[model samples]
Target: MYALLPVSPLYAGLALVPLALLLFTLVVLRWRAHEAASVGMFAAAAVALAAYGLSPEALSVASGKGVWDAVFVLYVIVPALVFYHVIERADGFEALRTRITAFTENELFLVLAFGWVFVSFMQSISGFGTPIVVVAPLLLALGVKPVYSVAIPLVGHAWANTFGTLGVAWLALVQVVEMQSVAATALALGVLLWIPNLVGGLSIAWLYGRWEAVRYAFPMVAVVSLIHGGGQLAAVTVIPPEFANFFAASVGLLALAPLAAWSRYATPTDAIERRPVMAESIAATDADGSSPTAVADGGTATAADAADPADDGLMSLPMAALPFVALAAAAFVTAVVTPLSDALGSIQVGLSFPEIATSFGVVTEATAPYSPFSPLTHPGTFLLLSALVAFVVYRRKGHYEAATARADEPREAFSRTVLATAIPASIAVVSFLVMAKVMDHSGQVLVLAESAANVATPATYGFFSPLIGSLGAFMTSSNTASNILFGGLQQQTAAQLGGLSEPLILAGQSAGGAIGNAISPGNVILGTTAAGIVGREGDVLRVTIPWVALVGALVGLVIVALNAAGLLGVA
Candidate 1:
């Protein structure tokens, strides 16, 4: 093996330039995601070539890998948008929205339901930003402002990033890092992630109406957090990690009924109804006799013209929920059924890349199959199946056929919506992923991690460990990728630090990566695209960043305290 390049302050600082520039462009300049990601991609390429001595061929391989990865993400995006449009054309959302309002008109409780509980449920089953893409618009349909609509789910589902999606992120961490105690790591992560789970629920309330909303929603948030976080912890100890999040989130979803039945939340409170985060009431109509719905650019759309229920007949709530039910069933079978999951996962697709090395000797090993994708088990497959099921069922029910002359044909509308939303989103995802690959291949990510590790003492290393993982997630916009990039580093650093519990530190790393999804540019773009607020990514970030930081810092302190108290190790 060639000796790796020595880390230095100058090299580390140079390594950080792309990410710094990305943040500046995104948050300060308020550039659209595609624009900002493209700029960052070029910056990373420059830094990789000039400072890290990355070979052009290696760069090509990395970029190609990034493109391939983007395809995986796009698979979900395209089908999800198709599924969304299919539902929209069937007037399923209005039916669902009506059902939700009928269940409880308390705005705070409504926000928590779609934003926290339902989004968490989505993440548990299909979490490649699926929760945000699916739930944000539902919130908007309930008359929430577009920005908060996107932001709410962004924060709400972040805590599930590590263990959700059938524990893909957790499995990735295990694959990359050799751990002394897998069970301990799982338990620690279960405990640590609870903070964000709790914080995310409360944050949604706070975002809706500030302190008053929090006070109003506190009991419900507590109950949901217990089911979501505590239930996950309890489940993980006895059940397999893959089933933990799904069970917990499913229970949370079930609990919502009773929670909504509680006297306080069952009736509309005038105080809670006056939501600061929602747009004008859904009943508000423009002079043209159309109901105004908030659009992403702070504009209103005449959605009511199409969405208003007519005498012909609206889809029943069960029919409206059919697609998601199908989606959940498909995901459950593929993820939880052992024989079916194995058989479906047997046919995998991946590309092989030759071992590549930078001039400085950082090496990426050659593999027969890199990042293999099992198409049948993928979230995209589930989404597409759901879309197809929705079309057939809705058509049979005469929902789509009943559309007015003004409405486009269902198939044509679905195709148009998918193309419009997926194309720009694909570009942004590719740009962001390629930038992440370049940074990783160039040893820039390593330098950043090592620089942080080197700067911290054992006393302070716990605090910095999760931050490194957060940095990785911010760059990659994936907890799985973040763990793959930094799991070993976190493990090695913990060993080197001495007295730090490896499991605790790794748990912190996982927890930090989980929460970081809230502010990841790729994730933000997914939310914005789904909510029809594509360019206002900066606004969503502005809302989510503080929550992420707050949750991340709390995770760090928990790590520190656990380490100090000698509770980090497995008994």
Candidate 2:
């Protein structure tokens, strides 16, 4: 019966309705963001319930999955944002902003150069939306228009989306393909990224400010790309893939000398120039329930600085800087320091779904690893640690004062964090769960995969794989999910058609998922929101889609060339 079945085309088209509704409701109808999200959420849930034929048992299973998804988001995303928020509340972002602007005032240099380097750094440390979240505001503060601020990061950082932050995309790819992961193939993929990453860097720079600044900083751009791209590739092949981003960032940090040497053509440094001033008043409360009142700015105060007397109680720049620097260092150490990580591994939180899942023949009771021995180990833990450290640093420095208008309490911090991030995250989780359930119940992913496979010729698999990958990202709005859905299908088709090694074909799948993230509607929405250009998502898409297509095509061509050259041997 299964073999005789005609695949349902409706399932594929049906999957798009929610996204379309999002466009219509959010863009055309001009609904509030939350309202649009709510409508999409319910629509997806209805589809899932209807398509899946959810009985009590099935509903139970779906609920379990949804809860887990929410937990994952809460555990990882919420803390990261909270950490950022606490620092912001403490006036650390302002300090960091001054330091960056002081270093480079040219908008293009800040956007292109800083965007590439900083995005790469963040991706290596924390891959999921980290680049967009961190860089968008930084760009905004540097005087780039809010819209371009988000768009630039999305475009330039797209190439590294696969092997980034210790190869999350590759890890997911392994699950889908069910093959022994190849470090060499993963490394090769990262090496190949240099071409597109460089191109993306240049394109983003030119788009940000034309030839004025990027033209002058060409050598620095080249060196940064080479160091970052090369170091990432080397780490994956030589060390563990988990260490890829950490090592790359570490090495790239050291390459500042080479980058500096390459910029010898410039008469004087073209970086930002800021005046020195006294540190601002910092009034942030610590995790330990104490508020201090001495915050220092990263730069000196100047006559040109805005004088907002009402905000003088904010924390100093150095206090704010602690969290970011600490977070990066902790994440790096946690991934690399096996002894410390293993020790922290002792504090795991095992989640059990006993009777509820078994009644439905679904697996539950997955372990949520939480080892404080590796206190700074997980990305979430690192972010939390950074927040804690920021509190301490600021308090000790007298940047925070206990009796100065408010008490330093963890309750207030929790409330603000939940209000800002948790609400949005809940909406996102519900939407994704319903969509996944709908696709699974309707057998949509399988039908779509088969149809996609039948459409391509052997020579065109390279090109088509990326398109399929893009479709998956578009549908799911996640590179990880896209790989999970299509990686095996692409590998199987490659094997059947041309006998290509499964790893290489699977690698192609992973690569495509990475590129597709740039234009994915969900990513665009989140990025635009973070960049403060909410309703203008279509504008960002119009600019990003072409670049995404071009990069995917380039990756596809390389895959084809590799296959033809016998570089990826037929099994």
Best model number under TM-score: 1
lDDT digits (tens) for residues 207-281 of candidate 2: 644565456557767876777677777777777676676566657656653444343531233442321111211
Best by lDDT: 1
Error of 2 at 137 (Å): 2.9
Q: Candidate 2 deviates by what RMSD?
A: 8.5
Residue-level lDDT of model 1, residues 1-571, one tens digit each, is 1257658899998988898888889889999888888989999999999889898999998888888888778888887778877887777777777766778777788889989999999999887788887888788777788888889998899888898998999999999988999999999999998999999998888888788888888999999999999999999999998779999999999999998899999887766544557665433533444334544355223232234444346677798889988988898777778899999989999998888889898988887688898888888888899999999988887887665432544244556757776787788899999999989888888888998998988878889878888888888888998999899888988888798989999998988899899988778888887777777888888888888888888889888898889895922
RMSD of each: 3.1, 8.5
| Local accuracy by lDDT, each model | 0.83, 0.59
**Cα displacement (Å) at residue 545, model 2:** 3.9
